[model samples]
Target chain A: MRAANERVRVAFQGERGAFSEEAAIKLLGEEIELVPRPTFEALFTSIDEGASDYILAPIENSLAGSVHRTYDLLLERTLHIIAETIIPIAHHLIGCPQASFDDVRVVESHPVALAQCERFFAAHPHIKRVVAEDTAGSVRRVIERGDPAYAAIAGERAARVYGGRILREHLEDHHENYTRFVLLSSEPRVVADGDKLSLVVRLKHRPGALYYALEPFARRAINLLKIESRPVAGQPWQYRFYLDLQAKMGDPELDAALAQLRERADEVRFLGCYRSAQRTEKERF
Target chain B: MRAANERVRVAFQGERGAFSEEAAIKLLGEEIELVPRPTFEALFTSIDEGASDYILAPIENSLAGSVHRTYDLLLERTLHIIAETIIPIAHHLIGCPQASFDDVRVVESHPVALAQCERFFAAHPHIKRVVAEDTAGSVRRVIERGDPAYAAIAGERAARVYGGRILREHLEDHHENYTRFVLLSSEPRVVADGDKLSLVVRLKHRPGALYYALEPFARRAINLLKIESRPVAGQPWQYRFYLDLQAKMGDPELDAALAQLRERADEVRFLGCYRSAQRTEKERF
Candidate 1:
């Protein structure tokens, strides 16, 4: 286990104000030096080459569901998960200084953001909605274009970063929308309080194979937060299952259960036990 | 079941020349009047309100996973799947008249399109990739901005529709990239020689629930084309499974298997059985 004052460098995919960056800061804090990587592969490469101490990546979102690429990257990379955080997604509708409601003919944002703001757009039938790559990137586009007719649905922080005014806040249809992020570090941290264990296991593609693979956790009464599956590369009709168990890896019961699971599973990889973020109560302003 | 050549109005979510438009046209043909809906929910509401005869929505793509909202909408609405079509996605890099690769600093398009052209972007690291709501929408932005540095990755048809120049064609990383769209009509369609079945089922959130849910198809030797699971609304830890079966619903064996599956499932809904698109070799050019 690494010491706290080691000046851990964390890498995240996206620009400065991306939601992923928010997750990284929340997990590692201001003390850690942050590194930005353009792609998920680059994030992993940074960790592998010691360019970054850790990589913070999104695993799943409550509304959008699992990010399959992140799961595939986990399987492909040798990095270990040392922590986890769940960030609430509060999408806001923002516009540049040159734009007003009357002048705004089109709204630009990520598809997920657009989908989230469907209800909001329903009222403004005249305005065309456009999806952008990243929330911050959309804000930048609105700034660069300087078009009064163009607005973006992005994060509140993104609006501030890109000098965009907030047209509307909390534009997502669902209030409980949250994205879960996992921190991948080169060195595993010692399991502590609030730690949640994550594991990736490949089971035989046969009846009751999953049942046998999960029996160990069930026997230990270990609560699971989530379970997602992604197809194994180069293998047809086969999948590798990713599981999140709400127990520290250092726990005696969990350790024994994992050993048993390893024996039953065709292949089992420990993705490290990380501290889970405390569920936040919805804030009313 | 609706007879062929009957006048039917269909709603699609997108502007003209959008892939969804192509899918809608292919399914309903020139006989049906296509109503363009700005939002996906409006497409469903149009059918529910009897404003349109049917709706065409995308279910999944080979590269991008399932369109989850569509799945949730299917569960929320009473629309029936009357047909299905698979469209090969050929992304083209397009730009405004004055834009050139050397002058371009930013490339904009849908996230899926941006993801598909990852290798292309990697080679041109100087160009920043931006995402938008739609490929055509991105082209519109480039033209609206009139910036030579702005390029869009869109469909060839979109380039023609938006009057943008095709800077580079066939930019997708994978040649086999395809998107499967589902046609939801007010009434079901009779099974034909090439008909395929689509089913939605909910299983008890037990360890072997998924295995049991898949048993019927496996037992009948039905080729499972796609299987996706979305969280059941208001039910924590529960999932609703969406599947596409290669066998026609009219087949006695498949009918019997579906009946058996319904008995075992918590809730079973037959979306519809419709003709699968004929597989053709993809054009390299």
Candidate 2:
């Protein structure tokens, strides 16, 4: 077993000051060694490649819905969720030190960030929207170029990390936007107080099949927190459901419900059992 | 009702030779007037703004999963789906007439198209991938630039429209790639022989709410083709379920099931009942 006092290396997909990196720091702490991978595939295989011990990946966003890439990649790999965290996504207009808000002619950020600030762009129709590979990386590039005409939409951490000036705050259209991330490990984390259970199930292509699978859970009063259907790759229209349930692991009723669900569905995968974080700015690090 | 022989004007979100344009022509034929909108929001409002008679928007892709923007925007509007079409997605490397495969140093295309050709980019590590706004538009720009080093990945139609040369064929990772688009109108067209039904339902926040909603269709042996849950806006963690079923409109059993469903669920929105297209390429334009 690894020592509790040892600093852990966490791998995330992005540059040094990316939103994922900020999330990794918030979940694991600033002392943890952050290993930044360029892509999702690399982040998932980091532990196997002996680069990092664990990974933190975004699973869902309140406004944009689910991150399908993360869900698909997580299922393709043999990883287990150990913990979960929620971070408020606040987009800020960051520019070079000499740039003012009116001096910006081009705005750069990840596609996801740009999409969230649609109203902002609609108002500033003259500003050309440029797509960058990473949010934090965009801030770094514009600052390095020392261009007053270039601005980036990203988190506050990105501005601070890259020493970029904040031209405008709360540039995001909605204030309720938040992203949910999950910490995944190679082994099943023995979560002592885990109350949220995540699983994926493949149902038979027959009428009433899904109903029968949910019977045991509903019958036990177990709250189904979330349910999303994703197409089964190589099968075209056929799909499997991903579920998040509110029940503690090893509970007698939960165990019984799982036993019944296993018999009804063709395949069932236990992803993880972990604590769900409440959305509160006070809870943030 | 308008005459069936009249040439309808159709709007889609992309350039003239985009995959969406290809899909629209496949569904409505070449005689229809094609109106290209710059964004999904504009595409949805084209009818209300009196810019076009109908809009053809992509709903899902086999390899990439659902288009969440289309889903979210569709729910926000009061449009009815009148027809559906599935088009084969084949990515080809297109360059200027003077460019050769060996001369291409940069590949430009929409993020979606670029994502589908991951294997191609992996095989050619020296080629840089740049994200462009549209697939066909990228081809036009690269041809205008007449740069031998610049290439765009798009459908075959783009090559002919912009006078670009096909540098490589079938760059997509999967041969089975297909995208399904829905034709929406301001008023519901009388679709005879419609067999597929699409609807969105909101269930009470309880353990058995969703299971009961599915019971009505299941007991009658109606096939639930798909079910996807998306979070309800303004309410965090709460969701509404979108469903597609294999049942004809006006069928006695379907009507009965829907009535029962309405009584069991909090809210139900009938999106459309239309003829689902077969995936055979022979049925394409």
Candidate 3:
């Protein structure tokens, strides 16, 4: 751990005012320094470059499934998942101070952001959607152009950062939409207790291989929160299964189950044990 | 079924020469009529509008996980999945006939397409990448403008349809990129023999719910291909599990497995039973 006087340097992918940045502040509080990277590759390499003390990367979205790049990178890079957090993804319609919702003819954002606001676009058929590389960057462009006809759909913090007016609020199609992010560091921190566990395992290619692998947890009444099997690169038709279980590392039953899993499966890897973001009180928008 | 001479009308969510259209033709053969819908909502509602006989929608990608919109829409709509197909996703950089690769300074396509060719972008630092609404539409625009400096990354079929020249081939970072699409019709087709099975189940909220649910298949030595649990909308925390298994509809063991599954789970719905595209030979790129 660093000194109390020195603030934590957190790195996230995107422009200054991104949803990832908002999540980092909400989880780490207002005293941390934010370092923004332009791409996923850059964000993952920031820790190695000594640009930041920790990296916050999105693992999955409520509607969208897993973020494949983050999952693959977590395995490839030598980093530890210290903690995870979730935040509501709310996109607001931002524009120049002179512009109102009615004056907006074109809205710009990342394609995924544009896709999420389909209902808003459907309601306003005359407005056109243009795609940008980043959501916050689009707001900056609109503010720089000072065009009443141009607007952007992005997080609320973007409007504050760019000094743009909020033309509309909550343009996202789903209110329950949330993205889960994980904090990564080079060294693993000692945890006296953690409620969640994540692991990756490769099983023998057979019919009952997975069933037997899961039997250890089932027999002990452990809850398997999620299971995802990704194709192993260079090995066609083979998969590496990722499982999220509701058990801590220090538990005796958990240790016994892992011991049984190691004997049953071809290979097993323990990623981390952390508290579930679900256990925390959700922030009301 | 209609007469064999008349063409089958299939609707897909994209422009005329999209990868969806290519997959539909590759699966249904060239005699079918292609109906291009502008959005996923439009594509799903095409049958209600009496615009098409069937809809071909993408379910998942080898790189990306399941298409969430398609999975959610599949549950909401009354359509039945009759057939499924997998096709290689080969992105090619297309420019005007007069332009050469050296003259290109800008690239445009769907955001996902641009992202898949990350290595290409990394190599050509001078080429600026822009995001368009659709991949095929980008190629059409590039051909219409006839600018040497502007090019679009899309499938080879898009270049042929738009009369553009392929500036570079195989721009994807991974060579094994493939997309799986499912054919949905209002009426279910009768299949005398099929090897693959897809079903959805709502499990009882318990610790060992999923493990016990898969016990029947394990006991019968049936292969469980994939399992995905999606959160039940509005129900919060609860999930509806979707499973893909390697068993046919007429098998005695499969029937017994289904009987046991129904007894163990709250609800079970069979999505489809058809031949998997994996059994077919992959096209050499």
* Per-candidate interface DockQ score: 0.18, 0.66, 0.49
Interface RMSD of 2: 1.3
**Pairs that collide, model 1:** A99-A148, A109-A132, A130-B133, A131-B132, A131-B133, A132-B131, A132-B132, A133-B131
TM-score of 1: 0.76
Please give the distance, in angstroms, between residue A108's alpha carbon in candidate 2 and its true position after superposition.
Answer: 0.9
lDDT of each: 0.75, 0.89, 0.87
Task: Sort the candidates on DockQ, descending order.
Answer: 2, 3, 1
Ten-residue stretch with the least lDDT total in model 3 chain A? A229-238
Best by lDDT: 2
- lDDT by residue (B34-133, candidate 3, tens digit) is 9999878899999889889999999877766567678778888877778888888899999999999999999999877888898999999999988887
Worst 10 residues of 1 chain A by lDDT: A276-285
Give the residue spans of candidate 3 off by over 4 A: A1-4, A235-237, A282-285, B1-5, B235-238, B282-285
lDDT (tens digit, per residue) of candidate 1 on A165-280: 88778888887687778888777677566467778988865545665676677666776556676655334235677887778656799889888988888899888876666433
lDDT of 2 by residue, B1-285 (tens): 567896799999988899999999989888999999988988999999988999999998888888988888889999998889999899999999989999999999998899889899989999999998889999999999998999999999999999999999999988878889999988877688888889999998788888899999989999888787887776767788889888998889999999999999999999998887853443553
**If candidate 3 were superposed on the true structure by all CA atoms, what would the RMSD be?**
2.4
TM-score of chain A of each: 0.90, 0.95, 0.93
Worst-scoring 10-residue span by lDDT in model 2 chain A? A276-285
Docking class of 2: medium
| CAPRI classification of candidate 3 | acceptable
